[model samples]
Target: MRILVTGGAGFIGSHLTDAFLSRGDEVAVLDDLSTGRPGRLDPRVAVHQVSVTDAAALAAVVDAVRPELICHLAAQIDVRASVEDPAADARTNVIGTINVLEAARAGGARVLFASTGGALYGMDAAIPSAEDQFPEPEAPYGTAKYCAEQYIGLANRLHGTAHSVLRLGNVYGPRQDPAGEAGVVAIFCGKVSRGEQPVIYGDGGQTRDYVHVGDVADAFLAAADAPRPGVWNIGTGAETSILTLADVIGQVSGRPVEPGFGPARPGELRRSALDVTRAAGELGWKAATSLEEGVASVYAWVLAGEPDR
Candidate 1:
């Protein structure tokens, strides 16, 4: 199989790229290198420094690559940043996705979109949210992603494409930037490495579905090989509280963690987790890494000086 992963040099994307490479697939990357690093990818894969918002360039690259599948992972991923500047978020998250879809259409490639699970579900949604739940996103980032998902469905209907959506949980693993806004696990590991306590906002009661990057990569692989188009949530289907996350990291790192509680961020979800039964039955995929094992991997990576590969 020939695959092109947009943002393939980033943390999760790089891991997914490696998974494809290990399976003897020819893989390439299209990334702006703004937050993604080429050093994280296998040298055998070619890297194209193109932003997804540039439709013509993306189409040209897709035409040249002629991939069987295009894994669209590039986006404006920061929720807070999206809240502050919604138009900017839509430019990258929404417009960029449309550009990718159009490029895929011209290049005769199927698409697999990466979406968010926790952010897409509203607070009123049942815990361990299902795919059928109506989305009431609190931030513009989720809204933009949902809009992009709409485009994916539209492409499938109008063009008869087999594009799919993977609604992801909180992904954490090596190659994740510790200072980044979304990676709280990596951030906590960085703090523990510096002999500092992790900070817990909102009384340490807020919870999220934490999924490992390796498992997430596997989920993408399964989705790519599946014969039909569908929407699935990739997660453990269990909620881990911020306080418990701190404890797990401490246990993994051989350090005692003491978290300082701060005022909860306004409009934060009290609880969120995905109901991934649909993915399990349809895609034959399930998250395998536990919180302890996942945190241990991050801690070990941190201790190893956070190598790119």
Candidate 2:
């Protein structure tokens, strides 16, 4: 199948692109290199240096590629940035999504949206949040993603556009931008590598469901193969505290460093985890990699200087 992956140069999208290409699918990657690095994108995959906000460019690419499937992953993913400037977040996550959907609809392509599991569901409602739970997004980023999800659903209903919304947990692995707000694993690992004590916010007890990027990529692959449209939570259904995550990172990197407590950021979820039972039943998807394994892979990659061709 021919597929187009927006933000395919970024961490999660790159992994997904690799997965699709490895499965013998022709792939085209559209990325503006805002947060996505150029080196991370595979040379074999067709590359288009364009932002999703540019509807004309996106539409042209979609028309040329005429992809049977479109994996929309490009967005302003920083939650803090969203809080600072919500309009920017909406322009990217919401408007950019509409552009993708419009281009896909014009080109007769199906879409697979990368929605946030934690952001959409906010704090833990039922220990591990399920898809059916009401989403009370505390931040602008979550609100934008949720809004986009609704647009995707509407597009499916009205335009006959098929889409799968993968409400993802905290996905961490190699190639993740350490500077970004979402990349706690990379940020912690980088700090620990430099022999600096990692800073923990709000008593270091805030918990998140850390799913591996590879596992998240596999879920997208499964979504590509699955029939019909649906929303599914992609996570391990387990919560790991930030304190424990720091310890695990130190252990994995073989670097001993203390954690310093800092005041927690506002609008941040205290605890977030997802129940992946629906994904398992519908898409036969599961979070296969452990946090230890995922962190170790990231640490090793960072130690090796993040090489790509």
Candidate 3:
């Protein structure tokens, strides 16, 4: 199949691109490299340095590729940045996704959208959020992602476009940029490896679901192959606090990570985890990598000079 992966140079998207290529699919990567590093992408993949918000350019690429599958991963992916600049977030996440959907509809391609579970559900959804739960998003980032999900739903309903929206948890692994807003695991591991103290906002008790990038790539592949279009959570259905996560990273990196607590970020959620039963049942996907194992793998990757681990 011919596939077009938006944001294909990014952390998760790059891995997904590799997975698709490994399966012998012809893959075209469309990425602006704003936050994603071009060097991280494989040289064999056909890459276009373009932003998703450029509708004309995006449509032209889609027309040229005529992809059977469109894995849409491009977005403005920072909750804090969303708070600071809501318009930019909306333009990228919401408008950019619309452009992708339009291009998919025009090209007669299926879409696999990478949505966010941590941001979409906000603070209170359930211990493990089910797909049916209404998103009480507290930040513009979440709201924009939810908006994109809704637009995809509409495209599926109105245009007969097969689509799957994977609401992802905090995905971390090799090639994940430590500087990104959602890359807590990478940040902790990077700092610990440098023998620097990792700072924790909000007393280090905030909990999150940390899924491995490999598992996330698998889920996307499964979603692309599913017979029906739907939404699914891609997570381990487990929660780990920041404090515990820091300790785990410290242990993995062979460093002492004494976290210094500070005031929580303005729109940070205290706890968030996803219920992945639907994903397992529908997509036959589960996060096989444990938190400790995932952290250790990431630490090892960093130590190995960012090999394709």
Candidate 4:
């Protein structure tokens, strides 16, 4: 299969691109380099330095690639930044998704959107939220992703396209940017490597379903092989508190590391996890990497000076 992965030079996208290439699929990438780095991708992969927000250029790439499947991973993923400037976030996460859907439609390609399970469900949501739960996003980033998902469903209904949405958990692993607002695992690992105390927000009791990027890449592959259009929660169905995560990092670092506490940021979920039973039944996908193992990988990557590829 011919696949085009937008933001394929980023952390999870880069890993997903590798998965496709490993299976003997021809893959291409579309990234703006604002956050994605070209060095993360394989040298043989053709990367189009185009942002999904640019409809014309994205459409041109889509036309040229004529991919059978498009994994849309490009977006403004920062929740705090979304709260600061919602319009900018919408331009990237919302409007950018529409542009990808349009390009896919023109080329008769199917789309696999990278939606957010961590941010979409609100603070009051169930411990393990399902696909049927009402989305009560606290920030523009989640709202934009949810809105983009609606467009995907609409496209499916109107055009009979089998585009799918994968509501993802908090993905983290090697190649993740430690400086980013997301990927607490990467951030904490970086802090541990530099001998800095990890900062805990709101007593560190807040929890999330931290899924590994490699497992997330596997989920994408499974969804790509499935012959249908539907939303699936890709997660471990387990909630790990921030405090517990810090403990895991300390254990992986092989040292005693204390943490500092700070006031909780606004528009953040208190506790969230996705019920991935549907994904298991439908896509044959489940997160296989344990938190300890995943954290160790990130720590090792950080120790290696955080190589791009």
How many clashing pairs per prediction, in order?
0, 0, 0, 0
lDDT digits (tens) for residues 10-76 of candidate 3: 8898999889889988898999988777677778888899999999999999999899999999988
Error of 2 at 180 (Å): 3.3
What residue pairs clash in candidate 2, if any at all? none
Candidate 2: misplaced stretches above 4 Å? Answer: none
Alpha-carbon deviation at 112 in model 4, angstroms: 0.2
- CA deviation > 4 Å runs, candidate 3: 307-309
- Colliding residue pairs in candidate 3: none
- What C-alpha lDDT do the candidate models reach, one value each? 0.94, 0.90, 0.89, 0.94
Residue 277 of model 1 has an lDDT of 99
115-217: candidate 1 lDDT, tens digit per residue: 9998899779998999999999988988999999999999999999999999999999999998787789999999999998778878888899999999999
Query: Candidate 2's residue-wise lDDT over 1-309, tens digit each?
Result: 999999998888999999998899999999998877768767888889999999999999999989999999998888888999999999999999999999998989999999998888866477799999999998999999999999999998898877879999999988886656678899898878777877888898889999999999999999999988999999999999998998898788777758888899987899999999999999999999988999998888877876652
Model 4 error, position 287 (Å) = 0.9
> How far is 33's C-alpha from truth in model 1 (Å)?
0.4
Ranking of candidates on lDDT, top first: 4, 1, 2, 3
What TM-score does each of the candidates earn? 0.98, 0.97, 0.97, 0.99
